[model samples]
Target: MTVQTSFESRSPATGEFLARHRVDSSVAVDAAVRRARVAADWWAGLGFTDRRRRLLRWKHVLVRELDGIAELMHQETGKPVDDARLELVLAVDHLDWAAKHAGQVLGLRRVPSGLLGFNLAASVRYLPFGVVGVIGPWNYPVFTPMGSIGYALAAGNAVVFKPSEFATGVGVRLVETFAEAVHEQPALQAVTGFGDTGAALCRSAVDKIGFTGSTATGKRVMAACAQSLTPVLIEAGGKDAAIVAADADLGAAAEAIAFGAMGNAGQTCVGIERAYVVDAVFDRFIERVAAIADRIRVGAEPQAQLGPITMPAQVSVIRRHIEDAIARGGRAVVGGPESVRPPFVHPVVLVDVPEDSEAITEETFGPVLVVNRVRTLDEAVDRANSSRYGLGSAVFAGRRTATALAHRLHAGMTSVNGVQSFATVPSLPFGGTRESGFGRIHGADGLREFARPQAIARQRFRSPANLLSFARTARDMRVPMLLTRSLHKRG
Candidate 1:
């Protein structure tokens, strides 16, 4: 008998074994996709009203079991309970939004067919792509993956989720709970394992793929999907930065920047890895940031402000970035070399780092921040936009200045006075540009992302000219030229 392969999930906080999950082979992934195909047809046939009802029930189930799911998230991802709860709450809110707004966002609507089609009635609608494959990340597993899953399901497609290996237990719980709301239909299912399983999901028969991971891995996922001509949505890494103007609120900027950098142990893709403050206020901002960093307690305890790194190997990476900054003449304003202790990395605040240093250019997926001073707000914007990442950014300034500066940012989402506030509003689309990856998840655009636009036209009347029949009409050809000349002749 062939033995089945399995992997174990251990708490990064204490290295305690949490749960075991079977490694799904490519054959298993194919089977799941097939099941999803059947479920997609049934779900889509139910129409928007019935599907919305089912999804709302699923949302209710999630809300009722939020505590249990949050606990599993804490154990599997090594995040504090409150952090887990916060993430879960956001995920559930997205679920509710997606379910309630999907129909209106994607339903068929009358559209202008232009002057050439005056005799025809035209409409357009978003149609499901059948089955969608999702490759989730370990950090914020609940919130991140649901950004794709909830929207995809609301758009009338079945989902085959492949959660990160470290968060397999949490993935399983989510699938089970969703199953209760959608009994007997394989509308939502999870395939567990390591990278191989995720690779399998990419190559499965799903109609589209929603991937969240490093940029390097995202390229591989895209390549795999290319084999079958399947469409894909990639949500990758970011070296997000925050800009603090001379006229900005230094205290609020410090508090927001510190939380943006240290929250979730800095595993977020849109977290503030770098901060550029105006020279006039840089000193005060640094002082406030350091004080806030000092107050953060890194542990698995309830009172701790931040938790351990979910990935053990990331510890060395964090250490390397910090050391590289210091070796290159950067000064540690708060924690430094001693900050990285195994799975937990105490927040490290560095300043005077070179703009070209790895600390500024790279995505340090750890609780570390590098603050740099610029002579003016223009200089701050230039330095902030210099990185290859264009994910999420924050600008702290007066309303007009902040708005003006925000427009100049290269990132996909920019907050005027807060950090990551755009992510909380379900109406705004979230994603990035450049190496951070393409495509979006959230709101109306998110629902449309999982679907394809289909146009419909009905002949309400026949044109006297019979222009489309090609019945050798000289006027048919001359009429368009005359109309074009009259309508678009340098008006």
Candidate 2:
């Protein structure tokens, strides 16, 4: 295949051109990784304190240019400015949390010496993995990738980011802003291009790759990384569900489900794609959700609650899912297939969608929701967990029931009485399980994801019963055998 040399980004809301970016070749990607390796050594040598200071400086720089950065995000992704700003705010908050907590999370700590090695002292510390390659998605160009970039940098690893072609401008601007803060070295850099550019990064010598995109693209990334035996952290597609129990606050559940499913034109990875409401309250819940979803305006205007679909190809996918649901005896309570306009899809609330339909089974990543009625709360939980993609989920019920239902959901993260709330808390680990992809990108687990743990052992003094010594005779081992038997024989 002929690799495209360069690509131009245009506003998704309009056909207007935004900016053009050079597609980095394999050689360019290698050079960038080589630079990152050198920078990683220096960055790691800075220790936790210095790295924290530098990362905080970068956060400050991001805050200073918040408006400009958000504007660029809006132009490229066609998301509302306020939503763009909120994305930045979450990214910045994760950065601050990662910077401030890296030491405590990855710092050296003493470990207990087992009974078999009573004379030995042991300690463990998580050390950086030199370099990390990040492939970001356009839907959340800033916040989603920052979940990896910020935590990796905090853990003392140099990062070479490969952002989505649709959001090239925002990616480049992010790297440029980082240079402004950490001028001493290229610890954080971005390579812009299409799929081939990202593939090049995956095949490069980076210690690990952090990828966030569709499940299909994530599989491609894993395949490329497999050639080099490099590790990967994937945050892929999610057909997340929301369970509304009979006791749930119908108004609150409706509002959250509407916003969760339709926000950002329904481009969110962890957004609600399916909803299961108990049969007793299904009618009332559907009525409220349809009402709210109908009032949500979609446009490029500042006052609009939702913006245009950032990716042009997704418009057809959205239309297909809606049509499939309707064909399978589902009713469009709010908007029908006709609501799908190029670069814009109105909120679609589907009721009685077949369990096997595309809208319920696949990741219908548009402003569409499949709401189904369940005979009981247990049935709701079972239906919710039936999807192959279990990234995130929500449970709307009373405190006791919500907690119970949340725990029953087979997902990496779950929010009780709220939607997408797990993502806003910087201290919580993010990512998904099963086909939604593995590995975390926030909190302590996020820091450790970019680093390797090193265990150290030192002999405080020699023991007379040295079990590891070859010079010991059979009689010398008798005491240890008896002690071991006495200690563990009961268990």
Candidate 3:
């Protein structure tokens, strides 16, 4: 296939041309990696304190230009300015946490040499992987990619980011701001294009690749990286669910679930896609959720609560899911198939949907919710855990019961009595298992994800036995054998 040399970025809401970006070819991608490798050496040479200082300076720049960056994000992604600001706030917070904690998390640490190797001193430290190629998603142009970009930079690796074609402008802006903050080198750079460009990046010489997108696309990335046996950290699609137990606070649960499903036009990967409510309170809970869904406003107006679907292709998927649910005998309590308008889908609440239906099984990636009635909390947990994607989940119940229920769900992160709250905590690791993709992008795990653990051993003194030398005798073996028996023998 002939790769396009350039692409246009247009507003999802109005189709207004935003900017044109040059597509980086495989050769251009390789050049970027080479530059990043050079920058990585300089970045890694700076000790933890100096690196921290530079990162903090970049953070402050982001803070000062928050409004401008959020505006750009709004134009590029069709999200409300306020929502864009929230994304920036969370991204900045993660950046701060990663920068401030990288040393404590990845710094050198001593380990006991053990009895047999007492004369040797051993230590381990996480070293930067040189360069990392990041493939960001358009759904969250800033926040999602920053989760990887920020932590990778903190861990001392230079980054070459490939922002989704739909959000290329935002990505370019980010790289420009980083240059403004750290003018000495191109430690953070962006290469823009479509799937070919991302594939080019995956096949590059970067030590690692961090990707966030659909599971199908993630698989493609893995395949490309496999050519070079390069490592990858994938944050893929999610069909997250929320479980509402009998003892839950119905109003709070309803509000959170509604927002979780409808927010971002339901473009969020970890957003609530399914809700399983116990039979005892199923009717009341559905009514409450329907009420909240009815109040949600989705449009380009300033008063609107949700913005247009950033990617136009997703609109059909949302409509199809709603149509499939209704065709499968599901009832739409809030908005039905007619509620789906190109570029904007009003909140939809589907009930009585069959568990095997596409609406319940696949990721709709729109402002739609499927609520099902379960006979018991155990059944609710079982049904929720049956999905292939296990990215995030929520449990709404009494404190003690919620904690127990949260632990039972098969997901990477669970928010008890809340929705998508685990991502707000900077110290908590974020990522999912199974089809949702592997590896983490936040907290200590995120720092280590972009680095390599290097072990060091030094000979403090020579052992009298000289067990490793050719001069060692049978008597030396006998002494070690006797010592092992005395130290390790037990009842």
Q: Which TM-score value belongs to model 1? A: 0.98
Q: Rate residue 371 of model 1 by lDDT.
A: 96
List candidate 3 stretches off by more than 4 Å: 1-3, 486-491
Residue 275, model 3: lDDT of: 98
Compared with the true structure, what per-residue lDDT tens digits does model 2 show for residues 147-256?
Answer: 99999999999999999999989988999988998988899999878888899999999999999999999999999999988999999999999999889899999999
lDDT of 1 by residue, 204-267 (tens): 8899999999999999999999999999999999999899988898999999999999999999
lDDT of 3 at 168: 89
**Per-residue lDDT of candidate 3, residues 158-214 (tens digit):** 999999988888899889889988999899999988888899999889999999999
lDDT of each: 0.92, 0.93, 0.93
- lDDT value for model 2: 0.93
